[model samples]
Target: MKAIVCHELNGPAALRLEDIPEPSPAAGQVRLRVRACGVNFADSLITRGQYQVQPEPPFSPGFEVAGDVLELGEGVTEFAVGDRVIALTLHGGYAEQAVVNVNRCVAIPPAMPYQHGAAFPVVFGTSHIALWHRARLQAGETLVVHGASGGVGLTAVAIGKQLGATVIATASSPEKLDIARQHGADHLINTSHDDIRLRIKELTEERGADVIYDPVGGELFNASLRAIAFEGRILVIGFAGGTVPQIPANHLLVKNVDVIGLNWPAYAERHPTVMTESFRILLDWYLAGAIQPYVSEIYPLEEAVDALHQVVSRKSTGKVVITVGD
Candidate 1:
């Protein structure tokens, strides 16, 4: 099997394509003939040993994959061979074959393409759980999504609108803002030049946003703190901006603001029921055509490094997928 292997804790540039031995399924796991893999910003972080669950050196960085099941591990009866599924591998997805725990795998909808299946899990799941389960976003509330054009941010915009909240999207450029608008954002903020705090104040008649979904931390998170409603809930998705902002407890006390940190993958280990229910609802919405992944680019497995670079550099919109087998 061909795989992109990282021998040391460098960045994406250090990842190299090489022929590696095929992986086999263990008990409670299944071997997949990987068709496609989702390239996430976390893929870049894991390469540099910055992710939450860092595998040792000489590991692949892909987290989510979609493919056909070649064999089911012992004690796995939920799925049979040849079932099409999308799985959260945590790592080892940047290869022609991968072994993933059956618990982390969800059967892909029949109508969904391999690429869509690969792109769906991480971003959509993160945003859905963050807004619906964690934040408890309500209809008629004002929701703001920072980095609204990126992978997870785009999903937050769609989910916020689907939940009936008026969405205000913030991105670094007009082009990115336009993409967010097409995905159902009610208002747009060009963070490259606009005053985010003042804009939210103006847009909401000074009431501020009811929920702020921030995947880009740094200064944008600081702005969200000031622009939030009195009882607003802020969901901290990630620090894609490279700097994790320090939260001042005074701000939380004054406004009754709730800063919630979401580790989406934790659900798989600690709260499996929540993950299962979330996936059921998400798959239902997908079949109803209510939400769809916006895959901006697809790269061959040989160019997986370039794919990771595209996401790490924040140059691509929506999801970037790496197709494995033809």
Candidate 2:
């Protein structure tokens, strides 16, 4: 079997393709013949040993994958060989085969392509849990999404619209803002050229947004609080903007706003039922053509470094993926 190995904490640039022995399924796990692997920003962080959840060195750096089941371990009776499925793994998704726990794999919709299936689990699941479960975003509410062109941001946009919210999307560039608009954003704000708080205020007629979905922290979070409406909720998705923002109690008291922390990985562990339900909703949405993930680019396994570069450099528009095979 061939795999991309990060033998040292050098970085994504130092990742190399090497021939390695295949791994078999362990107890309560399933072995999959990987067809596609999703390249997330966390993959870059994991390779460089910067992410909070760092595995020991000499590891493969991928999380979500779509493939065919080759074998199932003991006590696994829900699936069988050759079943097309998507697996969410802690690591080792960059290989030709990956072993994931039976509880972590889900059957992919027959109509969904491998590229999109590979990219779906993490970002879409995170967005759904944040907006629906944590934030309790209601229909007809005014919703603001920061970094709206990225994978997680766009997923929020799609889900917000589907739930009947009036979605306002913000991006660093006009092109990215346009991408958000195409994904059902009711209004677009280019934070690079326009002041986000001011633009959002004007767009909402000075009432402010009912909910703010932010993956980009730092100064933007402060501004999001200022632009929040009375009794608004702010969903802290991630700190993709390099700095984690601090929320002052005074600001929260002024508008009665709630700043909710959304950690999907932790939530998935505590509430496995919700994770399954979220995947089911996403699969139904994909089948109905109501929500589709935007796969910006796909690279071969050998070009995994380039794929990571696209994300780390912020040059990629949507989810970037690595195709293990065709």
Which candidate ranks first by lDDT, i.e. highest?
1
lDDT of 1 by residue, 123-219 (tens): 9999999999999999999999999999999999999988999999999999999999999999999999999999999999999999999999999
Give one digit per residue, the lDDT tens place, for model 2 in 67-132: 999999998998999999999998999999999999999998888889989989998998998888
TM-score of each candidate structure, all chains considered together: 0.99, 0.97
| Candidate 1 segments whose C-alpha is farther than 4 A from its true place | none
Which pairs clash in model 2?
none
Worst 10 residues of 2 by lDDT: 262-271
lDDT of 1: 0.95
Candidate no. 2 TM-score: 0.97
CA lDDT, every model vs. true structure: 0.95, 0.90
Clashes of each: 0, 0
